[model samples]
Target: KEKVQAETFIKLVLLYNYRVERIKQFTNVTMGASTKEADIIVYNDDTCTKPHIVIECKNETISELEFLQAINQASAYAYALSGTIKYIWITTKSKNEYFLIDKDNNIKQSIPDIPQFGINKIQKYKYVYGGREQNQEAKKDKIKQQFFELETISEKDLINRFKQAHNSLWEGGKLDPSEAFDELDKLIFCKIWDEKIPRQKGEPYNFQIFKEPLPKNATKEQLLDIENKQTNDLFNRIITLYNQGKKEDPEVFKDNIRLSPQKVKTVVTYLESINLNITDLDSKGKAFETFMGSYFRGDFGQFFTPRNIVKFIVNSLPIDYKDKVLDTSCGSGGFLLYALNKIRLKADVFYKKDEIKHYKYWHDFASNNLFGIEISEKIARTAKMNMILHEAGHTNVISSDGLLQDIEIQKNSGNKEFKYNHFDYIITNPPFGSNVKQSEKPYLENYILGHKNINWLDPSKNECRDNQSTEILFIEQCYNFLKVGGILAIVLPDGILTNSSLQYVRNNIENWFRIIAIVSMPQTAFSPTGAGVKSSVMFLRKWNIQTTDKYKLIKQTLQEQIKKESCLKRKNRVSARSIEQPYPRDAFSN
Candidate 1:
């Protein structure tokens, strides 16, 4: 893409009447220990003795930080060259920055544009508005400028931009890492919102920097003030855009932009040019996931499930548009998003020719069928933002404990979709190694697995335990959320399956669900997330009402028959012992 950008810029230079022979692409220059390739180097004449300008072309989706790095790189190339290069031009397809370099004095100043071929004098800016309506006096000298439209970028580039923007906010601990992530999410939301706004082809975006024309004799102080004001104005626009998004979907974020004006500007600079609304759903979703995965793996790894595992679980399920799906411990919404993607791919097959129908088919599922619950408020918001980036399904993701009662979850989350036996599929990797104490959570008593000394044959003997491992309770919770015959794909520690002490848990699972499949995962499966426990992905189908009732009746009848048989045996043994003992005691003594 950078090579393509370079070629395109060369065409623009040629339009200014520069000779093709004088322009060189991939010109190598030595910078100390190694050589670097300059994207484009322009010479004053065909002789190519004097290097006039050094131009660096980058992909249009390049982040502001990368663009600046490119600028420095271009400068280094200029200094390395034997000839004195007077100007430096750095450009992406959508943005351009020009600089005037003084090598002897080691000074570089911002200039609107480098001079065109054969024009000894530089203008305040090149490519000014040139038509009958605007700047008529400069028509003869200035070239007509076209506005840049937002471009869709590749997933790799999008991820880089997200990471760069996030790093800039918290590089020096300006804000906590988690706080930085939140702020970055807010800015990205604003960027997407800005892209969705209706606009004509040539209109500029509200999120980008637009410097007003300044006086040629403007003082340094005056210039500083103008730049500061521009930053402030851009910050205000971001806030306005964020507010508008919040108004439409208030669940995405509850907090306002807390970064200083300058910090907000830094983030906006990276994202302002990309058209996130039109970017491929898979690309955007994965980009956000990758960016989030790296950050979360540091301090919040417990909340996140690896994408490979998430994909595996989602793919294994027979999910469709009509099925209401859920991730009880939906850390960053990995399962829900993957489920959404699955439906989207299905939509592509059925509605290949009809875009409108295709959109509705999958979008309806995202809007209505997908649901998630996250205990951490911050991670829940992250999950909501993750859904929003995927384009829908955010409203149903709630911040509350997955094991909470339906009413409590609904009340706490302000989303009424959570209910027992509601979801068609429950897919999640519930957090492991954590225990939910009966004292800490009153809802623990509500879970069958939460009890101690449970009698598989009788419910009356079940007593609530003081504490239960979370993974144990999540199984019951997933069962509660799933409808009869609903599918459940969950990740569990292997201890639950192999440990002798947890046979009761295994029994409870049998009572609740019919085992579908248990896939053994390697020890390293969760190592990336800082968990070393061996685990397995278990697929189960909940029992229907009739099946459950019939099983209970049969179990009760079998228990009664076994008890009767035991009683008869005991009576027979006692009769035999009494006859044999009397003969040995009283008769033998006589």
Candidate 2:
């Protein structure tokens, strides 16, 4: 916990903006007659605009004692700045905590001090071409001049090619890649690089099936090989990328793998797990219940939660390297993976280049930092695939009912390693629905702390038991999974927030958690559901709702207290993949 020096502030600016030349740090400047308002004030820009960002550092030993000193200093500067600005970000390197103070009324919300260059920023990035020729056409023509070769590639080939491109670009000198390549552009790059046989469209998207999906009458060895390939490939790619990125950016490796929303779907559709007789289960085409509820009969409904959404939730949580993060509803462990991504991102952003050599020693801080529990076999497998994809396949992702508090089975008859009270952060979008049976009622209680006698502990009365509500169970499960001071960010249906059905429970739960910011979502966000339902994303955290006054305050004041939002126009958002066609052509079929 070194004091945040002049150099530390410069690093923060660099992370925020990619095209930075240098930073000038100022020191203990005078404030009012009684005291100096800030430890440091940094002036920087995002290339196009220059804005002054004020930061207060805790050069003193950062125990719980110095938290207030840094915060108080930040508050004074932000209060003064807000008189003319919208927001100011403040942080302390020792504790690694960052928060944004709203200038209007100084609403201070603690944000995790993550790396400035995160996957979210990468997604928002669009490449700008510049050349001596000067002008849009010249810039485009210049980039186009470099090369364009479409290597007729399989999904596996696409990833490998990206890996090669990644390594090549890193070696070439830390360049930012343009928006990800389309099938056409990738081929063009290959051709420009002198690959004579680039594949063209209207042809096969090659299948490197690890294990052949044998015919209906196929034998056992045929099945075994398919299973082997699926599992082995799943394991290899994650470690390779993790190690590769470590060697490359080592600090910001996770920052480079950018995917748009559509690209996210592309990767998940390609992520396959060896499920025995999975196709047979779809014979009836019956809709089975999973976390997100009755998805399609086959693999249509399951996709990894997009990285941007995960990044949003991860940033909202109060997490650090020391905090034990858990995802009771870890879908492909997307949330956990992103949380780890944030931790690593912060380490890269804040620590010095030389200090970063201690990357491995931070493994335990990153490894044991997350935990996940999911129930659906497909989702669990998908989560495993995602964790591996994100290179956190090793971060204990348990395949079990998230709704169940802790369903004790025979724990190998002698496992003393299970600890119940270790988690510090929880972020997830648990399944949404209301048709479960009472047989799983106890699990929901354990899941969301229904029996904890906290004022927020409100379960649907047994008199009208509707255990069918997976969303309700998830709410409970998340509440129970957290330590007393832990935080959570959950995305559930809008109904759960304002639905009159569980007003009592909602009111009670409000006491145990604080509803931070609710980002109302548009309907088109979800797929066509076999079970028709509406959805919205909610962000809340665990704490006791001790008094009825606090409950009434949150309820009555929510609407007025919430800030109105203007939705981004279509052009700013990601395009739908279905408007054209999806990957694996006939892969999600028989």
Q: Which candidate is the best by lDDT?
A: 1
Off by over 4 Å in 1: 1-53, 56-87, 90-142, 172-174, 454-459, 556-590
Q: What TM-score, to 2 decimals, does candidate 2 have?
A: 0.41
lDDT per residue (tens digit) for residues 1-590 in model 2: 13456546565554343234323344344356654545545444433223344566654233333555666766666565423322244443322334444454335543322223222211111111121122233234322211111112233323332333232333333343322222212222212222112333222111111222223443455545554554455334333433443463222122333333223222322221111112222221111112212222224343345445566667766678888877767765657766776676676776663574445424555456667666654455445434433334343665556554342511421212224444677777777654556564544333332332333324233243334467766676667667666676777777777778667567656766777777876565554333234556666666754543576666657643442221333433434544555577788898
Which lDDT tens digits does candidate 1 get at residues 444-478?
Answer: 88887887766765657878899999999999889
Residue runs of model 2 more than 4 Å from their true location after superposition = 1-157, 160-303, 350-358, 393-395, 407-421, 440-466, 527-534, 544-590
Q: Please give the distance, in angstroms, between residue 416's alpha carbon in candidate 1 and its true position after superposition.
A: 2.4
- Cα lDDT, all candidates: 0.81, 0.45
Q: Per the 3 Å backbone cut-off, how many clashing residue pairs does candidate 1 have?
A: 0
RMSD of each: 5.3, 30.6
Query: What TM-score, over all chains together, does every model reach?
Result: 0.81, 0.41
